[model samples]
Target: MLAAIAAVAALIVIGLIIGFVRGRKKQGLPQEPPPPPPEALREDRPKITVDAEPEPTQPLQLEDLVPRPPEAPAAEARVTPPPAPPADLGAFRSGLKSTRGNLISRLAGVFRPGRELDTSILDEVEEVLITADVGVHTAGRILEALRTQMNGGQLSSVDDAWGAIREEARNILASGGQGLAIDQTPTVILVVGVNGVGKTTTIGKLASRFDRQGKTLLLGAGDTFRAAAVTQLEVWGRRVGCEVVKGKDRADPGSVIFDAIEKAKDDGIDIVIADTAGRLHTKVPLMDELKKLGRTVEKALGRPADHVLLVLDATTGQNAIQQAQLFKDALPLSGIVLTKLDGTAKGGVILGIVDQHKVPIEFIGVGEKVEDLKPFSADAFLEALFESPDALDPSEEAATAS
Candidate 1:
C-alpha cells in the first residue's frame, strides 16, 4: 500500500511542470531570443569604435579632384642652372701665331725707337704685307690708310700702326658678313673646290657642326671621280652619326648630289651637305661640270642651293685668290671656307679674298680638330692677328716664346 502512494506523488509533480511550460508558450516568450537587427547580423557592416576625439569631415570639392601643380618656389629650387663661362680667345691667338710671326714680327724692326714713322716705314709695312701674301690691292689700301694716320699724327709707334691695321681688317671682314645662312629647313650646301683643298674634310667638319646643334644631317658623296673622296666622306658620315648618299665609283656627281637632296626631302633631314669632285678651277670644262652640279642641286631642291661654299687652302697664298675668282665666276658663290690657316703664313690671303670679292669667309680651319673649323669672327681674327703677344694672354706669350 506504501509503494502505491509514492508512485501517485511522482505523477502529480510531473503533471504540474508540463502545465507551467504550456502557460509560458501561450504568453509568447522567445524560444531563443529573436535574431538581432539586420545591421547587427551583417558581418560586413562598418563598426564604429568610440574615440576620445573624432576628425572633422569636409564636403568633397572639384579642386581636390584635379591634379595640383607643383608650387613655383619648390619647382625652381629643384633645378640647378649651369654656370656661364667667359669666351676664351687663346685658341685664336695660338692658331694665328704663324701668320702673326710672318706679318707682325717683320714690323718689329720697321717701327723701332730709332726709326721715324714716315712714308718710308709705311712703304716697308706694305712690302711686308705683300710679301706675307696679302694681295697687292689690299696691301695698297692698308698702306694708304697708314699714310693718312701718320699724316694726322694718329700713329706714333708700332702699337698705333697695329690698331689702325686691326681696324681696317675688321672693317673689311665685316663687309663680307660673318655667319652662314641656314634659315631654311633642309638647307642644302654645295661644297666645291679645286683638287686637294680639303673639300671633303670641310664637309665632314660642317656635318659635325650641324650634328652637334641637334639637327639631322645627310651627306652626298658627289666626288665620285675619286673613290677615295667618296670613301673619306663615308667615314665622316659614320663618325658624325649621319647618312651618306653615294653613287658608283665613277657615277656622275650631279646625279649623286641630286639624289642626296631628294633623299633629304624624303627623310626630312635638317641639313644636306653635298661634296663635288675636286676639279681644277682653271679648267673650263671642270668648272662647267661644277656649274652643272649646282644646277642639279637647284633642280632637286626646287630652288637655288642655300649655300655654295668654296673651300680654299690658305697655304696656296695668292693663288687661292685666282681659284676664288674662277669659282665665283662659275658659281653663285655664297661663302668661302679657308682651310690650313694654322699651317700657313699666308693667312693674310683672307683680307684679300674678302676685300676683292666681298665674299664672306664663313669658316676657317685653324687646326685639324672639328672644333678648329670655327665660324669666321672678325674681332677674334683681328685680335689674334694684331694683339701684342704679351698683352692679351700669358698663353699667347708662352706660345710666342716657344
Candidate 2:
C-alpha cells in the first residue's frame, strides 16, 4: 500500500507541470479573435478606378490679326462731270476789235499781273477812267467795285480785279434788253453821229446787212449839204443792190427822207437805211433839222426811222462817250454802232459810252469791209478785253454752283 501511494503522487505532479506550461503558451499566442465574414471586410476597405478625374481650364484675348489699310479706289467707284457748252468759256468776237477799244485797253492794264491795288491805286484807276470820258458816276462805281472786291478777299491782284468792273459795265449795257424786233412794215435805220464817226460807212454796211438777209433794201442820201454825199450814197446803194433817193447836192434833208421813205413804202421794201449828214453836238439847229425830218417821216410814211443807229468812233475815247450822250438826248437812238477799232491801244471808250449813254452796242466795225461788222456779245467783249480768259479769273459767272 505505501509503494502504490508514492507512484500516484509522482504522476499527479507531472500532470500538474504539463497543464501549467500549456496555459502560458496559449497566453503568448496573441489572443487571435474568430474569423469575420468576407462582406464585412470589403465594406471596411478603400476602392480604385482605371481612369482618374480631370483638372480645371482657362480663356482667350484681342491683339491677334492684320496690321494696316489698302491703297487705291475700287473698280466700281467712278464719277462723271457736267457738260461744258453755252458756258462762258473764252470765245472772242471779231467785231469788238473796233467799238470796244477803250474797254480793251483798260482790261489790258488790269490783266498785267505785277501791280497791287490799294485805295490809292484804285483812285488812280477812277481818275484815269473819268479822264477818258467815262462819266463821274460810272467811274466812281467801277472803283467802288474794285475796292469792295479788295475788301472781300476777291480782288487779290490789280490785274484781275478789273474783270469785275468790266462785268459790271456789261450788266449796265445789257440793261437796254430789247432784241432787234423785225416788223411787218419796213425797218428804217437812220444813221446819226458826229462827223468822222463813220456814219456814212455804217449806213452802207447796214444796208449790206439788210440786203444779205434777202430783204428789199433802200437808201436815202439825206446829207445833201456835203458835196460828196450824193456820190457816196450812190456808191453804197450800188454795192448793196439798193435803191437810193438823192437831192441836187443841197436839197432840204427832210424832203429827201420823205421821198426815200415814200419810195421804200411804195416799192414793198423790207428795210430802208438812210444816211444823214454828220453833225457836231454843238449844232442844235442842225439837230433840230433832224427832229423836223423825224416829224416829216412820221407824217408821210407809217414807219419813221424805227432804229436810229448812232455810229461812233471807238478810238475817239471819252469823246465817244460825250457824242453818245448828246446823240441819245437829241434822237430816240435805238443802239450804237462802234467803228474805227483797228490799231487802237485804248479801248475803254466802249465802257464809257455804255456807262454814260445806257445804250447797247449793236454792231462793231472791225475793218473797212462791209462784212467786218459783227454782232455784239458781252462775253466775247469780255474775252477781247482780257486777251486770255483762263488766267485765274473771278468772273465764274454764277454757274459753278452745281
Candidate 3:
C-alpha cells in the first residue's frame, strides 16, 4: 500500500510541474495591450493646422466690374430777335416837303437879315401869303395883324417878324377841338365830296383809325352813282375788319344808308361812316339830290346826321374854298378833310378854308400810306411848317438876307 501511494504522489508532482511551465509560456509571450476606447484612437489620427496672419489681396480694375451705358451728345446754343418802322414825325416831315419848300421857303425870304421893320416887309409877306393860296382876304387880315404888331413896336428883328407871323397864324388857326364830335352812340358821319377828292380812301383810312381805337365800325356804300364805289368800299371794309352795307349800281344811296343805320342799331356798332355820291357843288340838281339824301337820313333814323365831313383836294387851292362854300349852303359841313396835302404846295389853302367858311379842319392826308392821314393839330402843323430847319433851302438863306 505504501509503495502504491508514493507512486501516485510522484505522478501528481510531474503533472503540476508541466502545467506551471505551460502557464509561464502563455504569460511570457509578447501580447497586444487591450484596445483603447474609440475616442483615444481618433485623437491619435493626423490633424491640419492654419496660419493666424494672411497676405493682402490685389485691387479690382474697372474692366473687371460691369460697364456703364455711354451718355448722349450735347446740343448747341443760339438766340434770335424782330423789326421796326419809321417814326410818325419823320413821316410827317417827309410829307410836308412840297408845301414847306414852296410856301414857307418863300415866306422866309420876306424876313431879310438886315431889312428894317417897315411896310415893304409887310408887302412882301402879303405877296408870299397870297401866292401860297391863303386867299386875298385872309392874306390881308394877316398883313393887317402884322402891321399892327410892327406899329406897336413888337417887331424889331427878322426873328421878331417871324414870331409875329407865327403868332398871327396860330391865332387864326385857333379853333374848337379838331377831333370829330361823336357825342351820340352810333355816330353817323356823312362824307361828302366832289369827284376825285379821295372820299373812299379817306373813309378807308378813317375806318382803320377807328378800328385801332377799338371802336366797332360799319361802312355804308351810299355812293350809288358809281358801280365801282360799292366794291371799293367793300374792299376797305374787309381790310379794316368792319362790316359794310352796300347797294346795287345806281341804287338809292339813301336806302343803303338807312340799311346801315338799322344794321348798326341791331349789331351795336359804335359808328356808321356813310359814303355819298361825289357831286359838283355848282350843280343845282346834284345839290338838290344831296338835300334829299340828308332828309332821307333824318327820316330813316329819326335824327339828323352826327357829322358832315367834306373832303377837298388841297391842290385845288382857292377852288376848294369855293367848293366848301357851296357845300355849306347845300349841307351843313362840320369839318373839312384836306386830301393831297403832300402833293400840293397850296397847303396854305387850309387857312383860307377855315377863315372863309369857319369850318374846322379835322384831318389832312400827308401821303398815300395808310398811316399818313393824321388828325389835324394846329400846333403840330405850324411847328412842322415853321420849326423845321431843313424847311429853308440854302439858296433861300441868301434870298432871306438879301
* lDDT score of residue 94 within candidate 3: 55
Model 1 regions more than 4 Å off: 1-88, 152-158, 389-402
Candidate 2 segments exceeding 4 Å error: 1-117, 127-135, 152-163, 176-179, 389-402
Candidate 1: residue 223 Cα off by (Å): 0.5
Arrange candidates, best TM-score first.
Answer: 3, 1, 2
Question: Which structure is stronger by TM-score: 2 or 3?
Answer: 3
* Alpha-carbon RMSD to native, per candidate: 18.9, 38.7, 32.5
Which of the predicted structures, 1 or 2, would earn the higher TM-score when compared with the native? 1
C-alpha positional error of residue 43 in candidate 2 after TM-score superposition, expressed in Å: 99
* Whole-structure CA lDDT of model 3: 0.78
Off by over 4 Å in 3: 1-88, 388-402
Model 1 lDDT per residue over 1-402, tens place: 889999998899999889887888899653443344566534444655537545335345444576766544532232222221222266666777777777766665576545655677777888888988889999998888888888898888766776787788777888755466677778999998899998888998888777766789999998898888888988788777789999988998888988898888888899999998877777688899987987888899889999999999998999999999999988999999999888577888999999999899888887775666777777778877877644434333233311
Ranking by lDDT: 1, 3, 2
Q: How many backbone clashes can be found in candidate 1?
A: 0
Q: Name the lDDT of candidate 1.
A: 0.79
Backbone clashes in model 3 = 0
